[model samples]
Target: MSKQNNYSYIGIAFIILVFGIIFVPRIIDRITKGDITRQESRSDYAEEKKAVDSKLSDLAFIESFGEKRKVPDFSFTNQHGKTITNKDFEGRVYVVEFFFTTCPTICPRMNVNLVKIQNEFKDFENFGVASFTINPDYDTPEVLKAYADNYGITNPNWHLMTGDKEAIYNLANKGFYIYAGENKDAEGGFEHSGNFALIDKNGFIRSRIEDGNPIVYYRGITSEDEQVNDEGEREQISILKEDIKKLLNE
Candidate 1:
């Protein structure tokens, strides 16, 4: 029981503490995975975290472009001609998309997918769809009303909007960050992609899908003079449905 013995005891305790700190995680990992070390544990943790993050992602691929800010407010009208804006959705989850009625490639498919979702989410709460027509010049309130009816989208929750062309363009480019513009030769007043933007209740563009509009837009099969064809646009119906379900389920 001398000072030398006390010092020796303290040194052993410190070594044991360091050993546990270094090896406990590895030991636990080995017992679970059968062949992992501390490094492997760290790697596995990161990968698991990434996979989980990828599943319920609250991020969009557009973040890398230095444009991940919140979506801006703007005015538009639904199929019923009711006034609406991003501000109205400040407390609700919105699955937004950009399309023009004359698009022969993407709009039809996108509508069909949205219809499927509307049909599937009959009982979903607070979550809804907001499709902003790129061809504001032609997709007037009446045109959108008929369009929504044609697709059997009877849900009051769904909104097909058309407003000031320039403002819609701004929302497409600056707010939602999707493709939308005038195309004099494109059989419509404007054109846009089929990408669906999944926006959260907080006005954040959370995720994007690759599924384009339905093939219905490609009907008539005529390259003769001019027509709409969404075939070349991205197909994002599946992702749209999945993420919409996720947001509503939340």
Candidate 2:
């Protein structure tokens, strides 16, 4: 081939590469409807894709609930002093966390991370955050409202909930399968998991993120590990955000 022809070929190839770099991701984003490529690793993406695919089948309910775990029905008051019930979340995907307003340890960090999630999904009508306080006696509606105000949480979907202590404990331990109890040795006189539960539209627990590790619906079960560092907490938030997107798409 002529040197001039070779140079032309090289230039065409360069132009193609530039266009690919600039436009391919945009095309993908348009097709996917958003940037769903933020998953940390190829394995994470594969796992989430598998979950999404399986969720379309009849086996999804079984997969999401290994032993048919469903969050038991309950009525609780939110920061706005309005009643919220399990039935209210019937057709929505919600994130739940066990916490108290006066917690001096992991609760603050957990709340901060939750704000990240709340902001990310604030515009999605199907997405919500339900924060159930373990210390119901201390965290009344007024207290929760104040705490929500401090965090600048104005979203009506983000419910700072407080209700029957025993009911809350049972829901946390039995329904969500996370820790929540009174402990004299623990900070603020209460102990609870910093983990977040991702509940599907049908009231099944689809995923759980404690610290940085994520357990998806089809994956095998795992317990919450609270001894996580700051980096792990941040990673957990990232995983939570990705999983929420997956659930929303479902």
Candidate 3:
């Protein structure tokens, strides 16, 4: 071929290279829908995923703050003269209250409410009820047993406990976060909380219900000068019944 023909071929090659550099990408983008801006469009699934992620974050935050508070370990004598301890309640859920058998006021109401709970949950093998007497000096195992009989409570899962005064008081005030102390000015010469505690299988104090409302732990006691009305007692027991079921299912 002549030199002029070779130059003509080189010019054609240069024109083709320039066009490919500028227009080839546009052509590919048109054919393949490869524009990055178009890929940023949102869909319902993406919105849903975002919402689910937000909910998960919120749940994580709640768990960080609401981790379970564990009940302290304890041992005491039950109504049947059996030695009961924290180990007996391991892997089980139970309700606990502080009371004496002979109290002329809240103790009777507390026992009646507890019997209601005992009857409601007696079928659940993992459920139990415990009443720790603040006046252990007078409430012996035999006395507790007699009190249990007076209530017609024969369920072995229900325990009326009596033990050292200080140990029982410590378990009430510190472990269960309830109040139990000697108050000469109070009814029956002793003061204790009317609120019932729901303990989980792992021994954590999961919930406390009083007066038909869920109250803060350790704050359900009637003051030495105050008395819990019958209406308040009934409401608390009703709330406690539902809370017990909730913890059991959990």
Candidate 4:
């Protein structure tokens, strides 16, 4: 080979050696330490996604005597004066609460959290809320409509319902077992559980598992921003939101 050609070849060989000594080790080190993304990284990501899916899918169904506790049949007039029934909630994930428009305690906080939740899933057509008035006597369709508007509840699927007092109470106490009753001395002239129930697409009551038992209801009295309430109970609104998402996806 000519001198110039030999020198050109040598220069190219030296450059290759330099690249191998520097860049190659870094590239190899990155691969070894998992710092460089590879097909394995995508696999790892899929595994993580699967784990999340599993967590979301594990929401427990509230059961009684080995049979899943489905939402009891109900028919009530909504804020718009339209009759709503359990069938209306078919194929949707929803939250249920018992509150009177004039409740003096817990109801406001409960609804504030609910409205936050409503906003979170506002874009979801299959997500909704069912606010059954404990004081149906006072919460007529017009009254319920005013309450919904006052609270900025804009979700089209949401329904603030009122109906026959006896049926409403039975639905709350006997059907859902959520504890709604008349209490003459109670702050709002009535007492009801400040817990919210989550219903699945199939009308089955669903909840999260704690210690292998379904925690049948979520504490609606606590706000999502309050991690711990005055009773030192952890706020469940955030988890409720997550569970709602899970059910919605299902």
Candidate 5:
């Protein structure tokens, strides 16, 4: 072929290539985002999508309860004279912590976090917080009641419980997977962890939040561990709320 004819074929091919690059998308992205005509034409598709989203918005798929385990079932009296059973709380998410009313350190910090939780979901129904005192003999129902009142724990959702020491200790270990016992000489008198546990509607332990205060944050780990700023407590708190909301919504 002549050189001019060859050049002409090359030019035509380049033009075709440019056209393919630029105009193909116009054909391909016919259903692209924010397209006017496509949007109008596919209104039914959009409506169907919207219907799906709307159904999802209103869908409430509460989870089914699994095999019920015997979580340290014990009889404890609430701050009020109401004798309470753990079975009464079977279908709700409750935050449980262990601290003596006489605790002088992390217990206050723990209760502060607990009160924050209570205040957070104050208007929400079926969520409660309980702090079972290790020194239950000392932290009687009256003492717990007074402590609750003094702490401005006005919401009925918060409780400070007192029971037999052995029962409370066992519940602290088996139910919450924390340590609370009669070591009355530890810094805050009787010693226990500053661990915060979230129990779901079906009594499944969904998550645990560390106390996170540097002064009291060292309780939950091994003895050689050091406190770091990024041990996932913040994310755990967010997940805790999400799981609680999911349980409540269910």
Candidate 6:
């Protein structure tokens, strides 16, 4: 062989030798340490994937200042005439709303949507609803019971609650930050926020994060069939249902 050809062969061998010394060991070390992505076991891969998915899929906490907000303690009478308190919802995922049995406008729509939610998660024992009546004087346990029957609210955990009017208002306005009051000028002689607040198993209020902020409440006035209302607000009941499932799993 020519000396020039021999030189070229040496150069090629030197490059190969350098690569073996510098990079091959790193590749082997990564595999040995389980740092190589493709070398991961199926179960390990699944666990890592689950963790990442959990971070992405988990709902946001409704926070006040830097502290996470939670559903405040409350005591009210349910349709069964049993006293219901915040303790009753421990270790359960629930939705909260304010309504009156006599409402002629938005209350029916709200309850209908709530019934749909109730039916969707009927099989899950840990899922529930807390419907607080804004007009407690008119919505006694008997009246609330009849209203629940009329609406087909069959979820055993679904509670139609009524108690002191001022306390109910305080819970709605100051506690949950949801609006509820006697509005003589409004339809049905009362007004309330047409939004539902989601509470997790631990009583911490939860919601979907959007644009780096917690939406805090789902629009109860919109049906799943109505994707967006005349006011251009998109219906959130579907997302709410999915979130309830997520919380239930958590």
RMSD of each: 10.3, 18.1, 9.3, 13.1, 14.8, 10.4
Cα lDDT computed for each candidate against the true fold: 0.70, 0.76, 0.73, 0.92, 0.66, 0.92
Q: Candidate 5 on 74-187: residue-level lDDT in tens?
A: 688889977777787787777777888877767776665556567778887689876788887778889998899877786676667887878888888866567877654677
- Compute the lDDT for candidate 6: 0.92
lDDT of 2 by residue, 165-203 (tens): 999999888777788899999879998777777787878
Which 10-residue window of candidate 6 scores lowest in summed lDDT? 34-43
Provide the TM-score for each candidate, comma-separated.
0.61, 0.66, 0.65, 0.77, 0.61, 0.78
Question: Which candidate has the highest lDDT of all?
Answer: 4
Model 4 TM-score relative to the real fold: 0.77
lDDT of 6 by residue, 58-177 (tens): 698888898989888999999999999999999899999998999999899999999999988889999999999999999999999999999999998999999999999999999999
RMSD of 1: 10.3
Candidate 3 to truth, TM = 0.65
As for TM-score, the candidate ahead, 3 or 6, is: 6
lDDT of 5 at 233: 35
How many backbone clashes are present in model 3?
0
TM-score of 1: 0.61
Q: Where does model 3 exceed 4 Å of error?
A: 1-67, 208-214, 217-234
Model 5 spans > 4 angstroms off: 1-70, 208-236
**Deviating ranges (above 4 Å) for candidate 6:** 1-57
Candidate 3 overall Cα lDDT vs. reference? 0.73
lDDT of 3 by residue, 30-108 (tens): 8667454455444556887887565321101111246646767888999878999988888787878888887987777
For model 2 the local lDDT of residue 86 reads 90
